[model samples]
Target: MEEPGPVHCLLFAEVTPPLIDSHCHLDAAEFDADRAAVAAAAVAAGLATIVIPAIERANFGAVASVCREFPGCVPAYGIHPMYVDRAEPADLDALRATLAREPAVAVGEIGLDRFVEPRDDGRQAFYFVEQLKIARDLGLPVILHVRRAIDPILKQLRRIGVAGGIAHAFNGSRQQADEFIKLGFVLGFGGAMTYPRAARIRELAATLPLEAIVLETDAPDIPPAWRVGARNAPDQLPRIAAELAALRNLPVADIITATTSNVCRALPRLAH
Candidate 1:
C-alpha cells in the first residue's frame, strides 16, 4: 500500500494553516496581566504569527523581550512620530544599531500623525525622515502608522523610498491606498472594517484587491464592533478576517489564505 504523502496527511487531519496578524502590539501593557494566556489564545484561535512594533527607543527592549518569550511574535523597531518630541538625535543611531543587532522584520510603527494636538511637525519630520533613511539603507521594509497625515507621509515616502512594507491601520482614500500599492506596500485592515458605520473602511475592505490587503488587529486599540469599548487582542483576528470575507463577498478560507500570503509578502522575513 502506498504511504500517504504529507499533503494527504494534512488534508486527512483536517488542519487549516494558521493566519497572520501583520501588526499587533502584543507587548502593550494591556496584555501584561495575562500575556501568555493572550498569546496562547491567539494560537488556539488559529493565528500563526503576530508582528509587534516598538513605538520608541524606550520600548525597544520590551518589544524584543515579547518576541523572545513568544516564538510566534516578531519585532520591529522605530520611533513613533508622537514620541519624536521626547527623542534625542542619538535615538536614531540607537534604532540603526538595534535593527542591526536584532532580527527585526521591519522598521516601523513610524510615521507622521497630524491628529495629535500641539503637533511638532518639524521634529516629527526629522525623526520620520531619518528612520526612513535607515530602512532604505538597510534594505528593509517599513511598518507605517499613518493617521490623518497620509499625504505628508506619501510625500516623504516618495522622497526616500525603502523596500515595500505595510501601511498599518490604514484609513486613507482609495487614491492614497493605490499610491501605497504602487510603492510596493500593502494596506492593513482590521477591527475598523468590522464596523458598519465605518463606511469608507468597509468599502475599501470590500473593493481593494485581495493581493494588496493584509490583516492587523492594532489590538488593545481598534476593537471590532462586537467588542466596542473593550480591549482587543490577537485572538480576535480570525473573526476580523471573517468580517473582511463578508465585506468582500468571498469565502472566509480565501480571505485567510490571501491575507496570510499578503502579509508574508509585505514582511518577507516573516516567511522564514
Candidate 2:
C-alpha cells in the first residue's frame, strides 16, 4: 500500500504570533470529553481569547460555566435563529433575567436565517427583535448570526438603534458590510475564507477596513482548510489570522492587533 501524504501545516511561519477567536462554541458536546485539553492547546497556539456565544436558554448555564473555567473565554447569550422552533415564549424573558443575573459580555448568537426551508420567518423575527431589545436595554453588544436575511436584520437593527455588535461569520455584500460598519458593528471573518471557492468573501476580507474586522474561529464548525474534515478549535486562530493577513496584504501582527483591538471595542466586557 502507498504511504499516506505528509500532514500539512496551516499557519504561516512569519505571521502574527497571537490571534483571538472572537466567536466560538467551546461549550458544545464535542469538547465535553476534553474541553480543557482543547482550550490549553488553543492558548498554547497563541489564541488570546475565545468568545463563546450561547445558542439558547438551555445552554446558558453550560456556556457560563465554561467561561468561568477558562481564563480567556468570554460568553454571550441569545437564541439562535435555526433553533427558533425550539424556543419557548418564556425563553425570551428568561434571557433577560439571565442577562441581569449572569456576567455575560454581550447578547448574541442571535439574528435571522432565511436559509431554512418551510421557514419560520415570523418566529425567527420575533425572537430576533426581542433579543435586540434585550441587548439595547442591557447596554450590551450583540453578536448576529445573519444568513440570507441581511436586509431584514439590518432593518430591525436600524429601527432598534443599538450601539454596535459583531456580524459573526459575515457573508454579505460590500454594501451590507458598509451599513453594518456605519452602525458601528464589526464584521467577523473565519474559516470560510480559507476555502478556494469563496472568492467573494475573500475579496471582502481583503478590501474591508482593518479596524472594522474581527477574527473568529466559529470552531467545531467552520474549520480552516488545513483542518477541513476535522473538528475546529480556538487554537487554529493563528492560521486564520495568517490567511486574513495574506488576503489584506498586511503583516500578520498588524492584523492581529487590529482585530484584537476591534474585538475589545466591539465587546467592552471582554476588556476585563
Candidate 3:
C-alpha cells in the first residue's frame, strides 16, 4: 500500500540528431538581438558545427568572437565581392595582420560576381588574387562565393595553383563542375536544390560524385523550400541534407556521413 501511494510517471525526452552546418553567418546583424539563442536553436536542432565566413575587414573581430563563443563554430576571413568598393587598400594589410594573429580555418567568402553590372571587376579581381595568395601562403583552403564569374574564378585558381576549397552554393554546368573538381574543390549544395524549379541544380547534384559533394544551408540567407522568405538558420541543414540525399539517390545517413566527411577533408581546420 505504501509503494502504490508513491507511484510516479517519467516523461521521455525526444533526442535531436546531430549534423554539421558547414557554412553560415552567425555574426551578421540579423542575429544581433538573439545570437546566443539562435546558436542554441541551431544546436538544439542538431547543428554540430558552423563555419562563419567573414564578409569584410570590419567583421573579422565579430566573426572570431562568435567562433570563440560557440564550441563548434569555425571562422574564415575574406572580402566579399559586393563590398569591394567599401574596402580600403589597408584592409588587405589589416586582413594579413588578422590572419597572422587569429589564424582562421580558411580564406573566404571571396570571389567574383558578374551579376551586378557596373561593379568594378578590377577591384574584385585584385582582392580575390590577394586573398588567394594569402590562402596559398598559409596553406589554407578557401570558401569561394562565385556567381556568374566561375570561368574567371577558375582561371585565377588555376593561376594561383592552390588545391581544393568549397564552391559554396554551386549553380553551374556539368563541365564547369568538372573543372572545379579537377582543382580538388568540392561543390556545395544547399536549399536551392530543394526548389522544384531548380531542375538543373538538382540534376547537377544527382550527377556529381558523392565524394565531391558537400551540404550547406548558407544560414540566415538561403532558406530551404519550407523556409522560403523566412530567416534561414543552421537548423535547416537536416532538411537540406534530405534534399541532397533524394537528389543523389542515397539514404539520409549516407549523405550526412559523406558530406560531413568531405567538409572535414576540405576544411581541415574545422576538424578541431
By lDDT: ranked, best first = 1, 2, 3
lDDT of 2 by residue, 1-272 (tens): 23212211112122244466889999999999999999888867877678889999999999999978986776789999998899998999999888877667779899999898877899999999999998998788999999889999999999997869899989999999999999999999999988879999999999999899999999889899889789998888888889999998888888888898898789876653
Worst 10 residues of 1 by lDDT: 4-13
Candidate 1's residue-wise lDDT over 126-169, tens digit each?
A: 99999999999988899998999999999999999899899998
Ranking of models by TM-score: 1, 2, 3
Candidate 1: global Cα-lDDT? Answer: 0.88
Give the better candidate number (1 or 2) by lDDT. Answer: 1
Error of 1 at 109 (Å): 0.9
- The lDDT, on a scale of 0 to 1, for candidate 3 is 0.82
> Candidate 3 versus the native: TM-score?
0.91
lDDT of 3 by residue, 1-272 (tens): 11111101110112233466767998999889889998887777666677889999989999999978876687789999989999998998888777767747678899999999779999999999998998898777899998999999999999997757899999999999999999999988998899999999999999889988988888789889998799988878888898888877889988887887788778776553
Task: List candidate 1 stretches off by more than 4 Å.
Answer: 1-15
My TM-score estimates for the predictions, one after another, are: 0.94, 0.92, 0.91
| Top candidate when judged by TM-score against the true structure | 1
